[model samples]
Target: MAPTLLSSPLQGFTDFRFRNAFQHYFGGIDTFYAPYIRLNGQLKIKQSYQNDLQLENNSTLNVIPQVMTNDPDEFLFVVKYVQSLGYKELNWNLGCPYPMVTKSGMGSGLICNPTRINEVLHKAHNESDIVVSMKMRMGYENATEILDAFPILDKYPLKNIAIHARIGKQLYNGPVDLDAFEKCISGTKHKLYYNGDITSLESFKKIQNRFPTIDHFMIGRGLIADPFLPNMIKNDTKAYPKNRWEIFSEFHDRIYQQYDEYLSGPTPIKMKMLGFWEFFSQSFPNPQKIVKAIKKASSPKKYQETVASILKNV
Candidate 1:
């Protein structure tokens, strides 16, 4: 069977502008998980998060709204907000490994406390009919943390639990624990989705081979670094299209124009694209050189020129 490819949510990176352009230019992702809507003690959703989940904004693609919270009321609030936007499922984010989030007993930090996990899930299930799914790291400090939480997770009727195999402490640095991931398949009754280090066709196949039962796979940073990767993997081809760079350049321009229009100043757009280039540069021969040139681009015109020059060589 062909694998189902999903675009994993990257907090600052995979917003609506990026998602729309990616879907239009490169079509392979079966669904896109919107970056989690974080309600930092406020019951109100941010306008930016509101814009991302607007039904008209995502009409062309399948998008699942996600939330990052340790509070049940916050979970229920987001659940109502997404359901009102016509999304049927809400993906809870317990996978984020950042220090600020985890330090607050949210994201991966909350994984260690199954009782709290139960509290949030318990309220969400009791109050709403909206489907609930999970995005989780194996644990915060260690892999076994999830094992302890599985009993609590299994009590609820979750759509699925997508696990990024490394523990929270490792962040995105170490190898994904395939052995531990394999254990996850049996650890719960819920269907499991594999995520982490799936950066290439070969890597996707390796994970697919190991966990033949898992059909859903999520691609995060890899999708931005190589936009054509999902399609190529789906088609099982190593070759790029004859106009690979052209398509990429066009996609780049579309996003650049939109971001420039929406953002007030040159610096903001430059920094935004710079965040993207941190991944984009990896596709080139000299990633450091590409990043350095982009960083040195102090103005919009200079940024465009730098991008053109980088693409010109490829």
Candidate 2:
């Protein structure tokens, strides 16, 4: 069976603009998980978050909105908001490993506390009509954290649980613990989706061979590192378009233009593009040099010139 490919949400990177452009240029992802919509203490959703989920903005793509909150009231508020916008499934972001989010007792920090997880899931499942799914790590500090929460999660009828195979404190550093993830699969009753370190066809195949029954995968940084990875995985070949550079240039240009139009100043746009280049530069040869050039670009014009030169040479 063909596996399902999901575009994992990365804050500040996989916004509506990037999603639309990616879907337009490359079409392999089965569904796109939007970045978590954060509610400030004021209970108001940011305009940028609202814009990201507007139906019109995502008409051509299947999008699942994710919410990052430990508070039940906040979860319900997001449920009603997304339901009003016509989304049928909502993903609870218990996977974010950032200290800022975890320190607030949200994201991976909440995974170790079954009481809080139970409270949120119970309220969300009973009060909302939409299906609630969870994207999470094994724990904040240790792998056993998820074991404690599994029973509470079993009590709720979640659509699915996507595990990233690492503790939150690791913060995208150390290797993903496939052994621990295998244990998680045996322990949980909900459908599972694997998310982590799938940077190449070889790695993806190894995981597929190991877990033949698992069909869903949520790719984060790897997707940015190699945009064609999903296509390669689905096609089961390393073949790429002859005009790969041309297509990639066009895709990058579109994202640049979109961010240019939305952002206020040249510095913001330059910084934003540079951030993307941090991952995107990996797709090309001499990535360090290319990233250095992009970073040295002080103005929008300079950045464009550097990108154009790199694209031409690559």
lDDT scores in order: 0.93, 0.92
Q: Look at candidate 1 and give me any clashing residue pairs.
A: none
Q: What is the C-alpha lDDT profile of model 2 across 156-183, one tens digit per residue?
A: 8899999999999999898999999999
Candidates in order: C-alpha RMSD to true structure:
0.8, 0.8
Clashes of each: 0, 0
Off by over 4 Å in 1: none
Candidate 1 residue lDDT tens string, 70-159: 999989999998988888999999988999999999999999999999999999999999999999999999998999999999999999
